[model samples]
Target: MGLDFDWTDEERAYRARIRDFLRRELPPEWGDIARHGPGSKEQTDFSRTFCPKLAEAGLLVPHWPAEWGGADRPTWEHFILGEEMWASGEPRGAQYMNVNWIGPTLMRYGSDEQKQRYIPPMAKGQAIWCQGFSEPNAGSDLAALRTRAVRDGDDYVINGTKIWTSYAGLAETCFLLARTGGADTGKAGIAIFLVPMDTPGVEVRAIPSLIGHGDIHECFFTDVRVPASSRLGAEGEAWSIIRYSLANERVGIPRYELSARVLEEMVEDLKQQGRFDDPAIQIRAGEAAAACEAARLLTYRVVDQKARGGAPGPEANVARFAVVTADNSVTDFGLDFLPDFFSGLNRPGYLAHHERAIVAGIAAGAAEIQLNLIAHRFLDLPKVAS
Candidate 1:
């Protein structure tokens, strides 16, 4: 049977409803706050009020099971929700992590007590969380992280620092990974932890960057102690759990939707300036739009796989690579045609898209890593010997 590219009537109605909710609820100054980026205090603070409203409207966690505050909605609806939210500059802020992958990961791997303590807040859109994966030396090579979690009686003492941690400054909890095995144990020895950010010895310092205020951070875990109950799963099980989490995360953000919106705005700006008649500009815009559509289609394939209950594989890597390319393509087109917008605060949406596009390849996972995965897994290429 051939694939159907059209959305069903019900799906179209669902998307329209979400759009109506956003049109009615978002403040006029939302564009200003959104320009500061999703991890900025301005946006995160807004999410505290905005997301609860989304939950109240049955729009926040619709894909989650009914027992977990959702209506047991289809996976496609979750993706539709994501596309609309992202297109509107993601007013959910850092809480999108809670809605996308973190809450579901916890539901899958967390214990009864852990789920009871965390998942409810997430479902209600009240929780903010940061991923504690990247470090100064580890970046894309997550298996090489050196943070240690040493057990002491019923508690584990965590030490070492994480860099480039988004929302670290404002998050109440951290989905942390630390080594529990010997020095040379690598990926096999790592374990996942749910540590409260307020726990003593946990220090978060903002990292100065062009991304946004309070966006990237350096999180120092100095002898931070948490009970063994905080561990999500058995030691050495982190890799599998992380894989599942990353699969959800890789395709979760509909960044291409935002990119396409930005591209359209750029076209409109050019048209207003009478530059739309330029064939060169039109060609470049068409290429950028094509990239955005390509990324969207690739991402849809991954979402389709998830909807069919198929485990995510190298297709996720391929889709992620396309997304990064699409982000860069639109941002580059904007910079080439509309340099003035990048200089001032007048075009906050363009500025926001530019900033996010700069790091799209590096965040989530590096573009190089995705290419490596696609090479080996998707392309079935042999690895080069060191």
Candidate 2:
């Protein structure tokens, strides 16, 4: 389910090193962790403990500056690191904001002092960061976020709620978006802040997932004040920064790992039940397998383009659209099977997951949105009058 892209002998050596490390370090309980998921305390504690292990092995944050406990390697190394982590189902201890989202944003916009203060702890997983973007009213349409931050001298007083906040219940700090300008702001006047969760007037309430996973949550801030230095970039620049950071994250490791894992499961189930010999099942299963591979290829293309210092426009849109379509469709063929096929799953998780998996096209960003971006931004299509 992973790639075998051609790489230099050095890249090959590095991948071997990672394999060696995982063979040594991954706990036997790794599968349990993946199934039940880690708690706020457990996940944070594990990351805090394991991150240093990754750093000691020189495999942490390969995309970041070397001074901050990172390998500072090129883009290809990232693929090896990610694939190794995924295939083993190891705890994603090092993927803290350091490798994926926050580190990149800091590299793009942080002051030197901000970088020094944040990057080292993140690289070592000694610190945890969460994102404050989604709200009850503004998830898919993220620009409608209602969190507010008003300036009072050198301090900005913030008040609002962020729902479905990833890891917020566990994180030490959050990179948050809040409105700084009045009613007419729309997307233009929102400001982002790097606010510590321990700050007064902040509350984290765990909102358990559809399957009872406690990681995602709702974070509330009321009269939480921080120095102006907490802001991520220039005033009102967040609209653009948020777009860039989020566009990168819309589909990354989760999409890759889930697609690969699901495809493998489907093939194994078919083989075990002796359905592989059925021409109908074979044709359907083969298409599912190929589609997973296609999703990975399209996703990696965006990662490759970014390595060469390109933005996400046409290529990213195409990848997202194709992958989302392939991902959701490939899994729902289970629906084509006899009802007896589902007898193996009596649990609430699988019972609900069957339906939810079909909606992947509309989950992160809808297929409709992906298509619109492709047309308006990539193909320069004119909007029809509403």
Candidate 3:
């Protein structure tokens, strides 16, 4: 018999260990904290407290290089940990980016000084960094960002605004992108900056969002001055660095894992209420479950490639699109059968899942972009001329 969907004993043990830790470490009010969403101030603050404890327990950053406070474990272990966290409402909050991609990005591109200054804090779960991508004009086409940074004597003067920034209201630093070249530079002129959020002239304004308060913000950097050492890579290198980070981020959240778990929860709730016996409802539930499974399988293929040290390709796009579909499928099932849960009835999990599902296609990158990539990269289809 071929090796089916079974995990190795060690892998199972690792997952069990994480599950045990969650049971022991999560506060009694964890559901309340998580209901605020991962980007909310309540959850981000809790992450600051909770993540350090995880670090001390050797569960944080275990996949990172040992030099950066990790045990140099296999990539599968890292992914398994992420799956468990996402299934449990991602108690790590904004720090998930730290372990998932930011720290790894810095490890590869950052100078010694930069790594020393940033990696240790992330490994210790003491840092919160917000992404400074997506300007008012550059949401999906990130290359269209208008933020600018001009070189000065031992410093760079940055001026631009980033919208839809998660954790900006409480982030200690921003992994920022700004055009250092002329306005026409497009992607080539862009550069990455590790800007401290507390710098003079930097401002963050909360944007009330369905996701939760404090979860999204508009960050305005007006003549934000920072030493040249803050740059993550060489001039014009932001495009490649950002691409690398996005590849890691594409499958980072394991949204399908959460969606699948939520689907089960919804079905169980329906059964308890004796509403699951209707054939119509059962068929829809099966369809939703199938969608979730499809998503999980697609994401696993990407993870498998990553485990084998392969660079991310168009498959990542397919996986991301699948995960978004799964999120929508599960959320739709809940909304159709349990409308009361979404209407201020305090079904926090359902509410959170609904909000997240609505944004899954838009966040990271748009769902349309994924379809475009699938057409051009996966199907070898010709692009239409504008």
Estimate the overall C-alpha local distance difference test score of candidate 3. Answer: 0.91
Query: Given candidate 3, what's the lDDT at residue 94?
Result: 88
Best by lDDT: 1
Q: Provide the global lDDT of candidate 2 against the true structure.
A: 0.71
Candidate 2, which ten residues in sequence have the lowest lDDT sum? 346-355
C-alpha lDDT score of every prediction, in listed order: 0.94, 0.71, 0.91
Model 1, 1-386: lDDT tens digits are 34468999999999999999999999899888888888988999999999999999999999999988999999999999999999999999999999989999998999999999999999888999999999999998999999999999999999999999999999999999999998788899999999999999999999999888999999999999999999999999999999999999999988999999999999999999999999999999999999999999999999988898898889999999999999999999999999998874668788878888877889889999999999999999999999
Q: What is the TM-score ranking, best to worst?
A: 1, 3, 2
- The 10 consecutive residues of candidate 1 with the worst lDDT sum are 343-352
lDDT per residue (tens digit) for residues 1-386 in model 3: 22146689999999999999999999899998898888887898899899999999999999998989999999889999999999999999989999999999999999999999999999999999999998999898988989999999999999999999988988999999999999788899999999999999999999988987688899999999999999999999888898889989999989899999988989998998999999999999999999989888887888888887888888889999999988998888888998887775657788888998877888789999989989999999998999
TM-score of 3: 0.97
**Candidate 1 at 39: error in angstroms?**
1.3
Clashes of 3: 0
- Where in model 2 is the C-alpha error above 4 Å? 1-5, 38-41, 334-367
Cα RMSD (angstroms) for every candidate in the order listed: 0.9, 3.6, 1.5
The candidate scoring highest on TM-score is 1
Candidate 3 stretches with Cα past 4 Å from truth are 1-4
